[model samples]
Target: MAIAQSLTTTASLHYTPFIRELFDTLLTDSWCEVSSNRAIEFVEGEADVAVEKLVPYETRSEQGIFFTADDITMKIVNSLAAEVAVEKSFFDPSCGAGNLLLGIAKSYPIKKNLNRTIEYWSKKFGGCDLHDNFVIAAKLRLIALAAIRHGLPSISEGQLASFVRKFDKFYTGDYLEADVGGDFDCVVANPPFGHVVASRSNEWSSGRTQLAAIFVDKIISSGKKGQKLVAVLPDVLRSGSRYERWREKLAKETSCGAVELHGRFSKSVDVDVFILNLNNKPSVVGQIIEWVPPVTDTEGSVRLGDLFLVRVGPVVPHRLEEGDEDFPFLCAKNAPAFGVTFPEERIKFGGTKFLPPFVVVRRTSNPCDKNRLITTLVKGIEPVAVENHLVVMKPFKGGVNSCLKLIKALKDPKVTSRLNNVIRCRHLTTKSISSMVLQGV
Candidate 1:
């Protein structure tokens, strides 16, 4: 059910082996119904595998997991494609059954006849996917859409045969290595997300990298001036400290626009996603990027980073030994919310240790929960070894009194709402916590 559930509205037609078989029969029957030579030839030629293989690689591999939901796909397409003129073009490097590309095509008005329309639109719209079955599905859906849009119950067999040839740009291939020519007006994609093993030589990130992040860099590098890239990327690329350098590099390449948070990709997939809009070229000189979208209600508020020395707890329980039996050890389990906690155990660690009069927030959180930040005050007399799962917020200028005030501010409902917008992922990032804006502090 987990694999089947990953299928979005776009991929709903062919999820299981039985469904794929039906889809295959339907496409073959449609070609026969049209009595078209080229369309039939195209379908038969690309039949490398059986219908069972078309159930999407997402079910089998981490590399090809998570497709964009229908609402999200249409939103990106309509927002970006609406501004594009009829003469302008759109392309998706990793189209994945043409979810985004189909939305783009649907946004445009249908021209003269179905054949002429497909001919003209095919040149304006282009995409490629590594899966051959996905490419076939995309072409089939486009042809079906053309027929429906043209106001016919169905175009006669021969009348729509030319469509199969018109979609020459849609093919089965890897976009990362392919030569993506032409200056497209907009390039939209929901690239795959997961840790990639191979080393990367890109300027944004090197060594082990995320596949989605690498796809973004490749797409940007392939883009021409005046081009726009609208991508649904993992939230970590925006808020994780590991990508801070990548963010810095991205700022120099493209002008960052909107950062819309869409919590948790799917019920099955644990990753959170955000829609990032960027123009390929740097419109402004020396642009300093604001990774998280700024909240508008901060009139008299200041960033938590300015008021506190925010850091993740330095203790890794398995790695450290009991050096001082008398020292206290504090972890999330024993750190009660809104209550004072004293470390009871000790660890032999040479890393940063926190003293009392500091606030501790649980690093793991859920946006769907009633409270996003679970806070506790540590007011012991001795230094404590805090577990890595808790984020320690030590006031820079304010001592014990400041810690109490900070706790009060964090308890506000507005703080929870704001933090939800800042980082939707389950694990709260240190950078995101630091970026938290506190009111009346």
Candidate 2:
């Protein structure tokens, strides 16, 4: 006799009479997980009923479907409950598949300590999402998780669904538009938010609206005086000219700091992200902001500002579509350490004399790269024009050998390590790069 897989796996879903009907009715064409290790492949067809037909009148909102990694979820949960046991109400306003709820249970040992009853969980943890399908999925996942914790081999579909619907209280609605209506002690969320997905809002100035910014505004605005809001946010809020106002607001209102994470969290995404912590704690002694404040160690350190007249390249638009001239242009790609691939992204250099023997450094990179500052020495006297992607470092008084030496030195591991703190949000601005302190110039 072959052993069957347990129901604990994310993909290995236990078959239930109600579950099958729920999928057939609501999902209509979604596939169930056959095994734990295998991916839950979705085979879809024409929906028997329209999505709006299944969607109730009360629940209608935009779906930001990005989810958090398991390890990340645990870390957020652990960090939130570090000083105090999170026995109070735990919530994720934009809860997806009950991942945060699971994390909360694991961290506090809710199922282990308090009896796994609908009444207990109902009071302990609650959340809301925009999508009804996600709400259903989240509820089911929570039920399955609870079943495992309670050591129940099999749970009736009707009973499990009833408990989840009654206690979980995860209805489909816009978290920002309407209130989830909870006096939460701990709030942890990793919503689908970024600058690309940002939309204009009447509250802020023209073009000042972003999904993350709006969410942060709402989160901080509605935040109670003595609650903690932990989130995984895009690095845009950390720096950038547009978010300066929000940054000031965040600094004044709550004890906020950003801890940058390493590597890509998922397959499709490879942008730099940070753990944003805002503790609205009553106490002031333990509150402090952690960031790379502008303070260079002046003791034997040579600032890059002294050596070069650093100026960001000018905007040269329509390079490919409407270019009328050909000249050597140095972009970020051409500025590899110790060398230059000049004349590659050829653009109209115009009648301007760019000259040569200038250092070009990459203006942007992910912090995970550790050493994002790639430099190249432009030696040739070709009429060279640089793009905005590179910062042209003109020598105050130097020659070819000096530029080469600077390039070699910058590429050194020690030098890059020193510059690590100076590089913010994977961008080496003219001000930041210039402020970089070198051991020996």
Candidate 3:
């Protein structure tokens, strides 16, 4: 209980301690069942110690428990709620501190009867979290929201226990295995991004992926036709080459809705995130939605994938030992940007080598960069080993002149805009590069 107390004490700073004293008073009044059911207890001794003096105990980043800022939470909820009818029946599988649930509750028009409103919405919204404290906090926040709207001075012990009992649908459990029933119309979540070992017997799961993917996949499988889903997910799920199959499968099962990019999760978290909307009604089955492909008005435009044998450089510098320097080795550091150059360095490796008269694009990219594709024409007569951090695009039509034309084509402003739209993560993907059209070439 000490660990739980400290975790709550810390979480309160981020979520605000508006209800901390109320909760402490309520729990001290012997409302222990609400806080201890199926709970994971913490070390007993630390509850008496000051929380600030101790190193912050964070749930592993893989748990994806980064609490959404109030502004961002409201934005996510508002964006999703705008698309569909104002429905009260909603659920958050990984409900952390009830940020998302409170956003939904606020969407309803103010009702005059506070008790009825609190009682009704409590059952209308369904949610589950692995942590008992989060579930308790979510219920309390919902009740407090009602109290604030109606201007109640205080809730008595009996009234507090009554409201807590009404939130029967919100419980503690693993979302992937829990059965939330078919009562909810909208399923909303910010599921964990960490990889989990999915149940091998489940047909919907394909072994390893971010937990967010698994959560969405399970919802799609169990959801009724026309059921709504709104989730905040990592940008990598949108653009990474590794998730292409995931996108394809999702497209096959659900209708394409919308993808709204929100730059960076927050000031503290480095990952970029986006809001995704979907439904069980499949309209564009098996057809991936082009979330943001560069629009074109010109004729005879073709994808670069159609022209070049584009692939990531095969050499992983750190994994291999420095053996005989048999081939010229090129990497992001040695490869000059926007210029043609040859490297004298060589490395020992038995892998695919790119010949001279090809283009090497640095894979390290940021959305804020002036040019998303940092290009260089590697000119030489002999084939050389390129580091995996660079993507190699060998022309199929001609030689060095084709490489030059490709490099020049990449310099176009439209290409930069298009690349930024295709992928915003720190690293570029071969899939995104290959998908870029040879515009203005």
- List where candidate 3 sits over 4 angstroms from the true fold: 1-19, 22-60, 70-72, 80-86, 202-207, 281-288, 297-302, 318-325
Alpha-carbon shift of residue 399 in model 1 (angstroms)? 4.1
Question: lDDT for model 2, on a 0 to 1 scale?
Answer: 0.58
Q: Assess candidate 3 and give its TM-score to the true structure.
A: 0.82
Is candidate 2 or 3 superior in lDDT? 3
**What are the clashing pairs of model 3?**
none
The alpha-carbon lDDT assigned to residue 178 of candidate 3 equals 76
Rank all candidate structures by their TM-score, best first, as comma-separated numbers.
3, 1, 2
Q: Report the lDDT tens digits of candidate 2 across residue range 90-128.
A: 778777656676667654543442135555667767677
Per-candidate clash tally: 1, 0, 0
| Residue pairs in clash, model 2 | none
Candidate 3 per-residue C-alpha lDDT over 214-255 given as tens digits, one digit per residue, 9 for 90 to 100: 888878887777778888888888897777777777788877
TM-scores for the candidates: 0.82, 0.73, 0.82
